[model samples]
Target: CLTGAPGDAARNAAFLVDHSDCPAVSLAGDLSLAGLAWMFSRAAGVVSVNTGTMHLAALAGAPTVGLHGPTNPLRWGPWGRNVQSLLPHSGACAYLNLGFEYPDPPVTCLENLPVSDVLDALERMGLRERAFAGD
Candidate 1:
């Protein structure tokens, strides 16, 4: 599942999920925070960008993979056990968190890390194994 308001990003993500063969669904603003927490509690694992859901999922005790871009994982990664972080190797935008120093953050430097990197991280964390094993 996914989270976002009805916007370009949400529409685009829905488009991708609809076209892809992955057994996935996108949930936008249809859920409240409590609902999200409940969903996370039921999830075997979760993949999220630098967003609240990532942290929530981790707190819910789900194995979580967090995609960090502008923010440094050391300072902002999800807090919990069974959590893994992925970030861009090196880039000017890598640690540029949005704040007074960087009032307007650029598009995610984390985007430099490709989808393959996420898949690989999940593989290394054995999320894929647990998922396919139906654990």
Candidate 2:
């Protein structure tokens, strides 16, 4: 999550920790290239929005999966053998209105994405495995 220089970084980190069991890491607004390299070296797989971090992940040679919301995946999705992008249908524009005041709208665009869809994509990318055997 490339949180621009804003207070949203801590707030988003808190939300991620409270809502999901997945561990979350938050970087300060100005991150150095060395810091990013360190993170990439330790990451098993990178998942991120269609942001610069996604490009950095590709440069680091990590298997990356990027989520597309308001943008078209065809035009903006990362280009690399180790990267996969998941995008909603073209007609689905719910994410466009995010951060805007709305009354009783359905779940956000990303929330509407089914888990099976993400899992299938991950499986195809070889990010998920059925088992590991000892030598």
The candidate scoring highest on lDDT is 1
How does residue 20 of candidate 2 score in lDDT?
84
| Global local distance difference test of model 2 | 0.65
Model 1 lDDT tens row, 1-135: 556555635784768767896565667767778988988988878998868888999999888999887767787888897899888766644454453345354454664788888878788878787666654
TM-score of structure candidate 2: 0.64
> What are the models' TM-scores?
0.78, 0.64
Writing each residue's lDDT as its tens digit, candidate 2 over 15-41 gives 777868544555656557767756765
Which 10 consecutive residues of model 2 have the lowest summed lDDT?
94-103
Model 1: number of backbone collisions: 1
C-alpha local distance difference test of each model: 0.76, 0.65
Prediction-by-prediction clash tally: 1, 0
User: What C-alpha lDDT does candidate 1 achieve relative to the native structure?
Assistant: 0.76
The true-versus-predicted C-alpha distance at residue 132 of model 1, in Å, is 5.6
